[model samples]
Target chain A: TQLLEQSPQFLSIQEGENLTVYCNSSSVFSSLQWYRQEPGEGPVLLVTVVTGGEVKKLKRLTFQFGDARKDSSLHITAAQPGDTGLYLCALGGNEKLTFGTGTRLTIIP
Target chain B: DVKVTQSSRYLVKRTGEKVFLECVQDMDHENMFWYRQDPGLGLRLIYFSYDVKMKEKGDIPEGYSVSREKKERFSLILESASTNQTSMYLCASWGQNNYGYTFGSGTRLTVV
Candidate 1:
């Protein structure tokens, strides 16, 4: 079974601070996706990175795929109270998508 | 816009009772998935269907079953609901594109 592990399971930072979350796995993935989920609701897709060393920026959030395709990272700049939520990394291939243990972010105002 | 609809928003059932969670997609997606989300476990795949009447067990499928009678609909069944089975059930669908998945609002189930 393939497993993805995320670091710093819980994060609490003040508004306007910056933070980064990492997702690591031993198995290489063909593509990786990032999602943000609010409480009591389903997750919404933020971005998808396919190539190694590829980086995609969505407004204040930047997502990068590892050079080996075995890891990924999500970096948020100038975080605000609205950024408080759970971040998830998913690897997709062969008609199946495996999700990593999420990173919960709390932004203090 | 693509839409994946889950039948229930919140459900409470007694232990040992049978439960059914229904999901439908308006985009006529060929692939549908069922996942359960816990506090630290993230979203664990329970079952997925690629076509009508065809199903595959996901990472965690011991106590769960699924049925896809039509192309746009997928149903997840819990033979016997238990306390451990209580979680937020999510439904997702994907088309030919590999961009991302479309998820439903989610159904929160509580087993008493």
Candidate 2:
């Protein structure tokens, strides 16, 4: 089975600070997606990257797909309290998508 | 926009009782998926259906079964609910070629 390992399982940061979370895997995927979820809710898709070395920006968040298609990263610039949530990365292949362990982020006000 | 709707936000059931979780999608997506989310395990796929009357077992499908008799609705059934089945259940759907999934609000099932 293919697995995606995420770094810094938990992150605590102050507002306005910049933070980055990484997702790495040994298996290559056709596409990758990033999602942010709040308590009691399902994850909301933040962005989807299909090309290797592609970068997509959504407001204050930047998502980058690694050149090898086996890794990805999410960076938050000037984080805010609203950004505190569970961040997850998912890989899609063969009509199935697998999710990463996830990174729980807390932005202290 | 794609909308995936789950039947329940929270449910409590006794052990050995039969439980059913319902999910519906409005986008007419060809693929629908059911997953259970745990604290540290992230989201583990329980079952998925590619088309009407078609279902496939995912990574973890030991105690779960799914029914997708129609394109827009999918149901997850627990033959006999157990304490270990308590978790947040999520439903998602997308087109055949698209990998981006639109998820429902999720159902938190507690088996006591």
Candidate 3:
């Protein structure tokens, strides 16, 4: 089974601060997706990176797929209160997805 | 926008009862998936179907069964509800082009 591990399981930061979360795995993936979930709701996909060393930006959030396709990262620039939610990284291979433990982020005002 | 709808947002069931969770997607997606979300375990795939009447077991398929008789609908059946089955259940659907999946609001099941 392919396992994805996320760093800083819980993050608390002030508004306007920049924060980065890491997702690492030993096995390579064909593609990777990032999702943000609000409380009591299912996750919403933020971005998907299919190429190694690919970077995608969605407004204030940036996602990067590692060169080896075995890791990824999400960075939030000038986070706001609305950015407070659970961030999850999922690795895809053979049409199946392996999700990370998730990072619960809180952007305090 | 693609829409995924779950039958219930919250459900309470007793142990040994037969439970059924229904999910529907309006996007005409070819792939549908069922997963359970726990506090620390993240999302564990229970079952997925690529086409009508075609099913495959996911990472955690024990104690759960799924039926996909139509392209737009999928159902999850719990033969005998147990306390360990109490968790948030999520349904998702995606197309064959490897696009991002659209998820439902999820159903929170509580077994006593």
TM-score of chain A of each: 0.97, 0.96, 0.96
Question: DockQ numbers for every candidate?
Answer: 0.76, 0.75, 0.70
Candidate 1 vs candidate 2: which has greater DockQ?
Answer: 1
lDDT, model 1: 0.92
Kindly list the per-residue Cα lDDT of model 1 for residues B19-110, writing each as its tens digit: 99999999978899999998878899999988899999998999999999999999999999999998999999988864788899999999
| Residue clash pairs of candidate 3 | none
State residue B45's C-alpha deviation in candidate 1, in Å: 0.9
In angstroms, the error of model 2 at B37 is 0.4
| Model 2 lDDT tens row, A3-102 | 8999999999999999999999878888888999998889998989999999999999999999999999999999999999999999876467889989
Error of 1 at A28 (Å): 1.6
Q: Each model's RMSD to truth, in Å?
A: 1.1, 1.2, 1.0
**Each candidate: chain B TM-score:** 0.97, 0.96, 0.97
In model 2, the Cα lDDT at residue B105 comes to 99
Model 2 lDDT tens row, B1-112: 6689999999999999999999999998989899999989999999999899999999999999999989999999999999999999999998866558889999999999
Q: Is candidate 1 or candidate 2 better by lDDT?
A: 2
Query: Candidate 2 versus the native: TM-score?
Result: 0.97
Q: Pick the candidate with the highest DockQ.
A: 1
**Against the unseen true structure, what C-alpha lDDT does each candidate score?**
0.92, 0.93, 0.93
Cα displacement (angstroms), candidate 1, residue A72, comes to: 1.0
Residue B112 displacement (Å), model 1: 0.9
